[model samples]
Target: MTPIESQWIERLKQLPPKRVAEVLDFVAFLAAREERAAAPQRLSDGLARLVALALPAITEDEVEDEIQAARRERRASQQEA
Candidate 1:
């Protein structure tokens, strides 16, 4: 596990049972929602809609720009290595 993630685990272990249950339930609920995208999502569904819509309208230029950025990152990593 990553250091940051291990730190979170240690912190959660200290919580009271009731609070731990509440946190676990909330995390499970979020993970389930993330697992089920591509089914119909509704706007009134709060965070579900927000996550579904966070990817804004994509244009050809925007896609090209992301491709260029990825290539640059890869090249930089290779050079550093």
Candidate 2:
């Protein structure tokens, strides 16, 4: 391992078992936090790919029609259930 990692190992070895476990838990928490932070950038990258495809833009009326159609379909499905 690198010098920094070796230093960290030495320090960890000096700690009590309970403190070592706490350090492990903190490292796991940091890793999970990083994954959560990356999610939004992943979504933005996907959206950028779709934009790069140069799809046709819809009018406001068309957008409203789609919303209404979706609502109607949802209502019909709920009623059938």
Candidate 3:
């Protein structure tokens, strides 16, 4: 194997079982955090494409009305909480 892989294996072998499990869990958490961060960009990219195609069909007034409605709903929910 490569030098880094060999070194990592040797280091892991010296650690206790609990420490090894902790390292594995931490690595998994890092991977998941990275995936979660990328998910938003992927979603936004898809939405941008849709907006580009649909922009001509929707009026600015409709967009503003929807924005106002969303803000009102958000405020109402926050007040409830």
Candidate 4:
């Protein structure tokens, strides 16, 4: 393997069984942490792609107006009920 990998193996070999297990656990935790960090970005990217496809020409101002209108309509209906 590479020199860094060889060095790591040698260092791990110097440790006791319990310490080796701890190191392995820590490595797994780091990998899991990395995966968790990337998951949100992946979700956001997918959402952006869906929005682009569904509303290619929609503007932020238009979205805000639509939201305000919907809120007003809902409130009016609630008052009637």
**Order by TM-score, highest first:** 4, 2, 3, 1
lDDT of 3: 0.96
Model 3, 10-80: lDDT tens digits are 99999999999999999999999999999999999999999888756768999999999999999999999
Residue pairs in candidate 4 whose N, alpha carbon or C atoms collide under 3 angstroms: none
lDDT by residue (tens digit), candidate 2, 35-75:
99999999999999999999999999999999999999999
Error of 1 at 46 (Å): 27
All models: lDDT?
Answer: 0.85, 0.99, 0.96, 0.97
Worst 10 residues of 3 by lDDT: 50-59
Candidate 4 C-alpha RMSD relative to the actual structure: 9.0
Candidate 2 local accuracy as lDDT?
0.99
Better model by lDDT, 1 or 3? 3
lDDT of 2 at 38: 100
Kindly list the per-residue Cα lDDT of model 1 for residues 1-81, writing each as its tens digit: 999999989989999889989998999999888767633454346667678877777899999999999999999999999
Displacement of residue 21 (Cα, Å) in model 4 is 0.3
Off by over 4 Å in 4: 55-81
What's each prediction's clash count? Answer: 0, 0, 0, 0
